[model samples]
Target: MFKRSTLSLGGTALCGALLASGCANHLQQRSEHEERVERKLLDHTLQVDIGEPKSLELPQRRIRIHEQKTFEVTEFEVTRNYDRYTPYQPWRELYEVPLGAVAIVAGVGANILNVFMLGHLPDSVTKDWIDNGVAGINPFMNIQSHGRAQQNLASIDEVQRDRRTESTSLPWSERPVEVQAGTQSYTLTTDRSGVLRLSLLDSPFAEQDLSHVMRLRISVEDDQDNVRSDISLPISGSLRGKLLEAHALIYDDLEDDDVSQWVHRVKRLSELGLEEEASELEQSLIELTHNDPELQKQFLKSLTRDAGRLVADPQASN
Candidate 1:
């Protein structure tokens, strides 16, 4: 009976040792899993957007010149190109005159007279104006009257670029994360904001611009361990380079617009050594061509048919 008891005690001790070993192994695995999750979150922080683009609009004036009874051409004029808007008034009123009141008043009167005859005022004592009158519009005119109408067009081209998002956080979940958007489902971790962010797992656009739209979701899980709902949000891409500027001209075109006007504007910009502006216009043309195959065909056909008139001849514009 003592031998049997000894054997039973040995068996119980072996069982206890086995349970302790199993517990250690389980704890190690849980620790390793947590470490891997931490590393993954760190790596995915680079995937968040810099920021959303802001919308910008500039006031423009259209001029139609009738040369001869049979011919007319349209020209575009930007109201102001200065970084900021300034109030218009007499020079004396805008700036302190170094000279006495009599000289200041005389100078102010002359400046006002020049504006009436020459269509523009002298630079204020406080501000210097860079005139683009050749491009159109007298630089000054807070002329105390005239109401301007600003339109917020509900078109895709009206959007502009602004600051980008700098950083974002990753989500922490115990189970394998499942993200659902509408009828579709994807597995992804959440960000600090509790939003599931998608990463371009492979750096396909490492060299090129990662300009693409993303569709994200807000997911809810049910008691049965199934996704109940995924409210989707479609995010637009950031606007960069001259593409952002092209949108303004694209939206400005009308149904009966003439291609020659674009060609002429581009030509003038090039002549003035405004390489950036010229490039923007050219890019706009290329984009418009890509959007409409028939337009592309027609544009190319015209280039070939009127090569001399469109490009080579000095007095070729119609």
Candidate 2:
């Protein structure tokens, strides 16, 4: 009997040890899971998007830069709150029971009296108070967050960081970027929309020898952070031909051709996407024709865009 008692005691002790070991293992696993989730929530990435190819004729705009940030969310939690209404509110039973009983009796008497009266009654009079409490509430507006994303989002922002989210794309507004074209390098700043705009004629490309200039290289670097990008574009052969043709037209006088050529070339150049060249040539055309009303009208009919923005003399208006 003593041996049996000793054996039973040993078995009980073993079971207790196993239970404690199991509890510790579970807690350790839970702690490890929490650590992994925290690490994943901190993961983030930034992507840079320069403008797409400007057009089939042009490679890209003079400049453009936009940024998008991405966040990694792994494990998260949320709290739910609701005021579910039903006819089974036991807490209001004391008052509701008496009211419901009275309502049924009144409804029957009213219906019987309606046999001689109008014979029609509204549903409110027949419905019991318990079921008709705010009868048919609109659940649409009832669902609301405690506050702005007041959920496990707070836990996701473990560092209390006020960072941009992917809900909307944010521009790299008013940021300075470095651009290098050929032998020239310049610092250009973006606009309010984070778009960098500079006319090719107004940029360093104007000074660089285009006879053999074949590629445009753009680089954006930030010393304060890890933002950086390098972009290279090939100056297509067709683009070069158009640029040189426009340049040649700049030196040739508008009067070198006949009277019928008053502004035809200007119109043609503008059509070829050479607005700056067309604009310069139109100035000569204006002087050649002295803004004669008839000729001005002819030019006006032919002109479009920048070349057309030139003013005709008061004589034309008269």
**Residue-by-residue lDDT tens digits, candidate 2, 158-204:** 22223332333566688876666566777878888877775444445
Report the number of clashing residue pairs per model. 5, 0
List per-prediction Cα lDDT, in the order shown.
Answer: 0.36, 0.52
Superposed Cα deviation of residue 195, candidate 1 (Å): 32
Residue pairs clashing, model 1 = 50-164, 50-165, 51-164, 51-165, 171-190
* All candidates: TM-score: 0.18, 0.42
Model 1: how far residue 3 lies from native, Å: 75
